[model samples]
Target: MDIELLRDYCLAKPAVEECFPFGPDNLVFKVNGKMFLLASIDQQPLQFNVKCDPEKAIELREQYPSILPGYHMNKKLWNTVIIDGSLSTQQLKEFIDHSYELVIKGKKK
Candidate 1:
C-alpha cells in the first residue's frame, strides 16, 4: 500500500491521530496519544516502524526477511516492517492492528 492508504488505515482505528512530532519528513501514527507507527514520508522503500514484542520481533524478522528490528528504536521493543514486501495487504493490516494494540497495552509515558 502507498502512504495515503497506510495513513487512512491507521487513522480509521480507534482514537488514532497523525502528526509529525519528529519533523516534517517523519510521519507518526498514534493511538490514545501514544505513537505506534512511524515512517519517513520522504524516504523510499515504503515501510513503517512499529512496536512489537521482543520474541515475536525476532520470529517475524526470521519469518519475513523484509521485517527487521526497528530503525532508531530499541531493538527489543520495536520493529520496522517493510510493508510492500512479502506480506499481503491483509497481513500488513493485521500487523498494524497488533502494533496499535501492543502500544495501547504498554505503560503510558
Candidate 2:
C-alpha cells in the first residue's frame, strides 16, 4: 500500500495519530502515544514497519520475501513489509490491524 492508503488505514483506528517524530522522511502511526507502524516516505516501491509477535514475525519472513526483519527496529518484535504487489491490499490492511492491536494490547501492560 502507498503512504496515503496506509495513513487512512491507521487513522481509522481508535485514537490513532500520524506524526513525523523521527523526521520528515519517516511517517509514524501511533495509538494512544505508542507507535505501531512506521513508513519511510523517501523510499521507492514503498515500505513500512509493523509490530508483530516474535514467532509470527519469523513465520511471515519465511512465508514472504517481501516481508523482512524490521529496519532500525527490534527485529524480534517488528517487521518491514515491502509494498511490491506480492501481497494483496487486504493482506496489507491485516498487517496494519495486527500492528495496531498489538500496540493497544501492550498499552494495557
Candidate 3:
C-alpha cells in the first residue's frame, strides 16, 4: 500500500495518532503514547517499521526479503517491511495491528 493508505489504516485503529516527532521525513504512529510504527515519508518503494514478536520477526525476515531488521530500531523487536507488492494489503494491515497490539501490551507492563 501507499503512504496515504498506510496512514489511514493505522489511524483506523483505536487511539492511534500520527506524528513527526523524529522530523518531517519520519512519520510515526503511536498508541497510548507508545510508538509502534515508523515510516520514512520520503523513502522510495514505501517501507515502514513495525514492532513484532522477536522470534516471529526472525521468521518473517527469513521468509521475505522485503522484511528486514528495523532501520535504526531495536532489530530484535521490530521489522522493516517494504511495500513493494510482495505482501498483500491484508497482510500489511495485520502487521500494523500486531504492532499496535504489541505497543498496547508493552504499556500494560
Candidate 4:
C-alpha cells in the first residue's frame, strides 16, 4: 500500500494517531501514546518498521524477502517491511494489525 493508504488505514483504527516524532521524513503511528509502526516517508518502494513477536519476526524474515530486521530498530522485536510488490496489500495490513495489537496488549500490562 502507498503512504496515503497506509496513513488512512492506521488512522481508521481506534485510538491511533500519526506523528513525526523523529522528524518530518519519518511517520510514526502510535496507540495509547506508544509507537507501533514507523514509515520512512523519504524512502522509495515504501518501507515501514513494525513491532513484532521476536520469534515470529525471524520466521517472517526467513519466509519473505520483502521482510527484514527492522532498520535502526531493535532487531528482535521489530521488522522492516519493504513494499516491493512481492506481498499483497492484505499482508501489509496484517503486519500493521499485529503491531497495533501488540502495543495495545503491552499497555494492559
Residue 10, candidate 3: C-alpha displacement in angstroms: 0.6
Cα deviation of 4 in candidate 3 (Å)?
0.4
Off by over 4 Å in 1: 107-109
By TM-score, rank the candidates, best first. Answer: 4, 2, 3, 1
Clashing pairs in 2: none
Minimal lDDT window, size 10, model 2? 1-10
Off by over 4 Å in 2: none
TM-score of 2: 0.97
Model 1 quality (TM-score): 0.92
Q: Give Cα-based local distance difference scores for all models.
A: 0.87, 0.94, 0.94, 0.97
- Report the number of backbone clashes for model 1: 0
TM-score of each: 0.92, 0.97, 0.97, 0.98
Which predicted model would earn the best lDDT? Answer: 4
Model 3, residue 53: displacement in angstroms?
0.3
**Tens digits of per-residue lDDT for model 4 on 1-109?**
8999999999999999999999999999999999999999889999999999999999999999999999999999999999989999999999999999999999999
Please list all clashing residue pairs in model 1, or write none if there are none.
none
Judged by lDDT against the true structure, how good is candidate 4?
0.97
Q: Report the lDDT tens digits of candidate 3 across residue range 1-109.
A: 8999999989988988989998999999999999999999899999999999999999999999999999999999999999999999999998989999989998999
Report clashes for each candidate as comma-separated counts. Answer: 0, 0, 0, 0
